[model samples]
Target: MRLGQRLRTIADMVPIGVTMADIGTDHAYLPIYLVEQKIITSAIAGDIHQGPYLSAKNAVAAVQLTQHISVRLGNGLEVVKPGEAEVVVIAGMGGANIIDILNSRPEVTSKVKRLILQPMIAAALVRTWLHTQGWQIVDEQLVQEEGKLYQIIAAEPGGSPVVEPVLYEIGPLLWQSKHPLLKLHINELIGHLRGVILAMEGSADAVKLAKYREYTIRLKALEEKIRCL
Candidate 1:
């Protein structure tokens, strides 16, 4: 019950009895919590680094859940075999890193039923890759922790895309639902877009200009939407 707000938000997306692989699991709190709550019968607590893996091992041992959870030392999904995990939870890392992990093991995506991701940055890039890779975005949610907003997406291996490039930029599902945190998330995005636009404007380089212009078009639309807020 005392779980951190961020972990709790991530935990809400896990369905009962689904085997999970917690990539970049620092102390393996998510898998431990899920196993204790009976939401997951088995889980793999994976960390690319040995320090974190040892920490996860100690934590699982503390909970007497070493049997239910397997803490493995390896990078990304390297410790997980194909068809091993039904649900893959990748958290506590940037979206780019998460994308790299998935990209490295294309077969892992094909084998899993669900992917729950919480990206520190570049979520749009992750969403973009998911779109091209035939992954379907079924659910999207946001949470604010210590003045920072985090986006968590629940996606599968295949489906029609409900979001466009701009939506990916603004998290279409979050905008449509009008979640209470949308205003904050939108404003931050707008600021980022504006900064990018301004920096691009100062540069006379044509290539950067064109790239910035493209981003500006989306930013302007976002600016207008945030206006009503």
Candidate 2:
């Protein structure tokens, strides 16, 4: 089975010979691919909705991986017991949602060896949560698929908190690694910030003005980072 560039990048972050639990597994493609490649011998494919849960079950059955992969329907980490998986993968969701899932089940998350997260938006929130929870980001990758760019973050237990606030938004590992998409990513952020600032240019409300100033500062920081890049 083949996985998309985003999913493949997420899969690449998984260590070999470890049990994995894929939250919001959708069709269970990631687990199936990992199992087929022998990266993991056992996995739990979990989804919240019935359609996806059944789809994941059928996919595992069609591939005859039922013995190795278990498909469960439950919310977030509730599908897997504590210490059941070495790695937990949460992808194709918003950053806030991912954070909520991790926050929802401390027992499950605290015991996991690693977390592979792919948040479609508000990635900074996810990064901040990880840092606050003492999960050191080990790797970060960018993959553009169908004109959309996705950020994949791999983190493990025990790491110091990120000091720079901007690093949370831009991803410290991505900037340090000098990812090929860093420039484009910065440009996109700058563009969005500019739009926000422009829209609030004539606002007389104090709250809006404060937000406007905040965005201006962020815009300037992004501009400086782009120049450095």
lDDT value, residue 44 of candidate 1: 95
Task: For candidate 1, give the lDDT of residue 104.
Answer: 90
Highest-scoring model, lDDT: 2
lDDT of 2 by residue, 1-229 (tens): 9998999999899999999999999999999999999999899999999999999999999999999999999999999999999999999999999999999999998899999999998998999888889999999998999998889999999876555777787899999999999988888788887887776775667336667777888888888888897
Error of 1 at 117 (Å): 0.7
lDDT of each: 0.87, 0.91
What TM-score would candidate 1 get against the native? 0.94
RMSD for each of the candidates: 1.7, 1.4
For each candidate in turn, the TM-score is 0.94, 0.96
Indicate the residue-level lDDT of 41 in model 2.
Answer: 89
Query: Per-residue CA lDDT of candidate 1, range 1-229, in tens?
Result: 2578889988999988889999999998899889888989999999989899999999999989988999999989999999889999998788899999998987777899999999888988988888888888888988888877899999987766556567787776787788888888988988887887777777679436668768878887888778766
Off by over 4 Å in 1: 206-208
Error of 2 at 77 (Å): 0.6
Which stretches of model 2 miss by more than 4 angstroms?
Answer: 206-209
